[model samples]
Target: MYTHTKKPTGLCIELLESQGGLISLEDFHELWSMLRKTHSLDHLYPLPTDTEEFHLLYIIISRDQEHGDLGIHANGYGIEDEGKYRLAGFACLVVPPNERREKSILSGNPNGICDTADIRIALLPAVQKRGFGRFVVHELLGHAFDTLRIRRVTASVVSPVRPSHSAAQKKQIGFNTKQICRIFETFGFKFEGISRGAVMNTEAPEDDKPVWHDVHRMSMLVTDYFEEHIISSLSTIRSPCHKLPLKTVRLSPWDTMIQRQEEEKRDLKLWAEAPKDTLANDACDEDGENSDVETMLGDDDVDEHDWDMANDFDD
Candidate 1:
């Protein structure tokens, strides 16, 4: 009963843009608050204070397709729908405004083609164990690569520990640290090493006692992605390499004759320049086998300029 839309990935995923008409900001915030209460990590990963930031967020909703006949839209097991789509999970992709700076020294400098993006994902407890989390990650990465042309995507998480919001509720209910790490790994992200004691957690019982977290970072490259998913995995009838199909080449008889004559003339000129025995080597040399380091930054005539601004501690 899942209505198939354009975005309809394998898991019946419906990605509603946070800035769009699918859902309201107040409702999204309320669902996030409920999520906070279940696992509640205010000290380690707190929700953004400004509602304006929600524009960068996406709401991952799950529908009760089987029961659509009854007009029922269950969010997940026991959670009340209350005329709202069941909030299954959410994700955010942070692209810094500067576009030149790096998220961390570990993420490295922008390689010009694929910009780096900071990734964050969260799933509701009721829908935690299902494969929906992986689908969400796939959708996000696909958007980053196809739409934004980003080359590398990264996500960092603090060392997992039980979280508590208040003295009364000490139980933690969300995905643990190890589980979270596995989700990223399943999507081809490599472990990029950790930043030791990068962030502090001050929610310990005693006000004087504070906990420090060594943030673990992960990264994925666009080339590695194409190699893994498209090249190694799938088969094609036209090209064995599995790249995009080439446009068909069609030529009329007159054009073909003219092209042959042109090719023959070029071959005669090449033979005139060099002996037939050494023509292959000369062609290789002309093809830049002896060329110096080449670059795609721009034409060589363009002059380089120095960066005038000092490095700010941002992104």
Candidate 2:
């Protein structure tokens, strides 16, 4: 469990493990419905049709605050209530299907190393733009690197694209490529190039054809975390580049095949012919014009009272 108190507003935020089963399925469904209504689901990959699919992953639940001065006991749990400690949102760590090592560790294999996991986070519209996302992510990274001993953590953000007709009607969702990059970069995550046509744009299809959008991939290694700490401590020293001493591990056969397939897909020309209006800005192009990108939110420098409808959605 992790707890944070926001200044001025006195809003207390807590991150709890879903293993406690404090939230019910029915309540979870209701929260999902709210996100959909607010179009917060626009940037996320489609959720599993079966809600129960979420049960298998490691989940961190964000809530309002401690129940009372007593606070939640280490072993005890709190039920959602209107007065306080309501459900805010959640962050989940999902192991890839092909990731046998992490899967084994998650399944209680004594010798397995939990080396990697994909992270996703979503917050309710009401609680967004208040530094909660940053707090949650900070605690999550500490837990992943220190407690879970995960070597690598991966995250992806949908690159900004021209809004389709349907998308134009709904409120914008998620952060733009620049905002997301800034957020993760501040946390020591390095850009890992873009995945072309990685996700379907279900909101706007052309002539009954599916429209795909590009995704920006980013990752942070445990070594990167240590390097960040060292750099922070050495405030006066400036290093042009720092390299890891560890050698890259050989990929497994399955991973090699998957990498090859991804390379092949990137080389294909079909995705390039996508309509101009629907095309996404090249996230890799540092100088590319990103007029489509939205203004960033949740920055400490920004006015705390200036609330926006925008929320976060990760996959």
Candidate 3:
């Protein structure tokens, strides 16, 4: 389970397993419709029409409010007394279509040790910017690395369309690629590169032609989790701030490595400079103390005379 303190109120928020199939077909339909109607899923592939065929790997986000409270409802699915937790949204992790177990086995990874998976999140509009997304992602990564033992976890964002493109084309893109990239990067995912014309935007078409958009791919390896201490660092963050770090794009693994090396060099330089600064301060303090003693002993006048004579000789 993932737990975090909600911002602004400091209330606790938890992501719990939906027990007893709490989310019924009608609930899923309503939630899916809302997301699609709001263009929230425009960056994502169409979910399966056959609800049973679609994976129900959901983690229900809940607030600290009492159960059955008259708050928002996921079509009546969220009000059930499941530990007195109010539902906010759901998040899930699914195996990518190309990285299924059969494909992994065929690729000589019988244990699927080298396989990768994808993460998906959906939240109510009210809770969108409230750090629930980050909390869910943190928990998902922990599960992927520690529980599922997956080698890599990937996330894709719909790249922004060019302004020169028709208005209809721009409307097809929903997510801000830079914002999404920053989120994943905070979790130690490196950019894998762009997938050209990866998904067709069926919602909008011009001249009866399919509108295809590029997708930005990013992934975090199991090694990155431990090497970067992502899990440990994130665990200490009780309420993740909405202000994300500065944006940067690492287009490939090589770029990521180079950035790491540059950061290490900068750190080493700072460390090396620190001691010199301390020693210089010490020398200045000693000189000041000696000068004060000389001034008290009437040697200051002689020193000033010598200083003036030295200046005259230089002239």
Candidate 4:
């Protein structure tokens, strides 16, 4: 639903003209093609559309102009000539407004991307370690704060130590441990806990062979708080052997007792119904015998008189 109505190109918001830079849909297509050619993922799904990803490229270019993302991504980043751009880097920028997770608690930041201007850049694989990834992110965050008139930004990426991944193993593509850490440090993104229910893999798949694992989710934010404490806070574990937190819910004894009592009562009632039902059926048989005795009185005809005479004679 996003249109290519406005876009910015080049570096420095101050250097931008009164109307700012504009990119045509054609330009976006060119960028998209370049990204595909660079990454060799022209066949991947859940990635941006050929025509669609350019819209995101538009946002990245616009924000990058003002150094918005740059303030956040600092490490392993080098500026292109005149701060224009670092070559040999690519990512499909996306808004994915509806696809974000539980960011409702983050009221100060909107849309879960951190700031209204906050832009998320998915780094292109071909240009990852060379530092263009950090540079692009830094520019995006800086522009979001300055030109876009926003406070901060947020971003996330998959963890390297994921449980399983058929695609990653199949594609021979997994996260870069050092690079991922570098990107977060550069962008002021913080480490939140791993989502417990997050699926790292699927045993069965629709189109392909059974997947053995899935990707892990990690979150980030662009803030002074994260910037000041990111390094120190990151060192909280100090070693890579940090233990995972887990909780177990125990069943209440009252519930167990109530369930046991109900079952016992039900069984007892079923057993108790047998004798009462048989005794009632026997009484019905005795009533039939009494009816037969009345039939024998047909010859006597005077039932009450006969009963009185018979009783007096018997005495």
Candidate 5:
């Protein structure tokens, strides 16, 4: 069902250059705006008001393969030129990967384990079911699990402004609603739960925050990836993971915890043996040891200080 977008049937997907440096912030605003209209999404990252700090977010753009003319649609979506490029699908990974609102993920831990990826994908209305959605999702997960070596991937289902169609998407009257869910499920994505109006609970009351209409939370594990077609794309593109050794080195969580405990105890012992003034001077030395980790990697509002504040935030 995937439409051929000038992309050869077997070539690896090119990780569109990072939007921060290669693409302008304005381009992303245009892209998010274009997707919001079609997907009925209420908000998009680097929100318009967030116009200044666009560099904080990462963007991936996937062009839809046009069917009839085999020409991409221009002005119809986010693609700059019509016949040359059409915005078929995209996934945005907002940073820093963890916000203060999410501390269980980033509290004094290796973020590679907390490498959470949020994706918001949309295809032009004209090219819904030619099988493009399935292929795109496969590629996204393939990259997340294999190429980029992301720890997990998550995306929320977006509903249209009005009733569009029934499930299964057998007809051509409306958008393909199940495509998003089915694509992830096919790759073994698990349904975490709903957020805001996750299901029929769209009308239900939320605690403290205003009630939202519809949002479904779904996630997938990102290791031991097995989609051949997508994997082929990675090989062709030479993603970063291609350079990593093929063998996976699995580690025991229990062993890791024990090591951390020993290290923390060692630090505590050091403090007990040192005088108060020595401890103050040692603090200066500690800065040199922790200089590499003073700030969060992919986000602005989430540093170590914010992480502590996050612990106090009501879940």
Candidate 6:
């Protein structure tokens, strides 16, 4: 079961898993389908359709009561045909493994034990300047820190360091990117690093070297966000709807893929070094010494039990 919280603006936040419940599963599909086509303010990046590989990908949809106008879609200025309950905007929370090697570039901890997550938010262009984006993000943080008890939250912002091709493109880049970084900064996230060519430009050819753009990573520790609550010795501050049972989802396939990749890399390393060691060792060397080589070459001794222990967390 998921939880529901009413925001000060009369918008209700429904915390849902991949399989949604507060809204019909069909509605959730419609939201994601729309999001896939929507671009950022600069029309630079769009949500990728293939998201099955990511674990702990949860959708946070902000909804408001139906009004005189159904309102405009976030992607375009055209009015939506949908009913009273307008889907104001949506955000995504991605939880990667604490020890993921690829993510170490962002977290700076190879064997980090703290629970951490990344956030990506998108609000309709019509609703862009109304503080809806900030609200959506706060809800996500509340869930991460209060419910999931995550220690750190990180977000990526497109940096203006990349060269723009046209005058129009330059203007779009300056406006949208700054707004993105500013929003996160307002929530106490600190500037971490600049990742060169980390973001891909959808308009450019995939093979083009410059298709990638620089991105600034920002992070907010839980201690910084909830400092006031702790200082007051309050049991729990009612920032996001209080004390809701957060849904837990276990994505086994993603975890399996990580384990498989780790094993493949380890095996390759062992085999690549085997040839060099065999040539240097004396033929008269003890059989026990040669046993180590045999163990590396023998696939039968590969431990399957160890792989089973690498389980993905339920978010």
Predicted model with the maximum lDDT: 3
Show model 2 residue runs off by greater than 4 Å: 1-18, 45-85, 99-114, 160-175, 202-204, 234-315
* Candidate lDDT (C-alpha), each: 0.56, 0.58, 0.61, 0.39, 0.46, 0.57
Question: What tens-digit string does per-residue lDDT give for candidate 3 at 43-71?
Answer: 55444444332232563545544333322
> What are the per-residue Cα lDDT tens digits for candidate 5 across 233-288?
44456446667335333333334568899999999999889575554345344545
Model 1 Cα lDDT, one tens digit per residue, 168-267: 3333312355456566765667777767767776455334655666677778888766654653233233565667565344443335678999999999
What digit string (tens of lDDT, one per residue) describes model 6 on residues 1-315?
A: 012223444343443345342444455566655554554333223344545323233333333444322232222212242432455455767765445545754677554334777787765554556566666677778877877677888887764434535778777775667666766766667767668777776555644555667777789888877763443334334446666343233323335568899999999989888464565456434653565555556556677784575556755
- Using lDDT as the yardstick, the better of models 2 and 6 is 2
Query: Local error of candidate 1 at 68, Å?
Result: 19
Count the clashes in each prediction. Answer: 2, 0, 0, 23, 9, 2
Candidate 4's displacement at residue 202, Å, is 16
State the displacement of the C-alpha of residue 260, model 4, in Å, after optimal TM-score superposition. Answer: 42
What ordering of candidates by TM-score runs from best to worst?
3, 2, 1, 6, 5, 4
Tens digit per residue, CA lDDT, model 2, 10-37: 2343332344555555556666666666
Backbone steric clashes in candidate 4, count: 23
Q: Give the range of the ten consecutive residues with the poorest summed lDDT in model 4.
A: 10-19
Question: Which stretches in model 4 have alpha-carbon errors above 4 Å?
Answer: 1-23, 37-118, 122-130, 149-152, 158-172, 175-178, 193-222, 225-315
In TM-score terms, candidate 1 sits at 0.52
In model 2, the Cα lDDT at residue 59 comes to 26
- Evaluated at residue 36, the lDDT of candidate 4 is 54
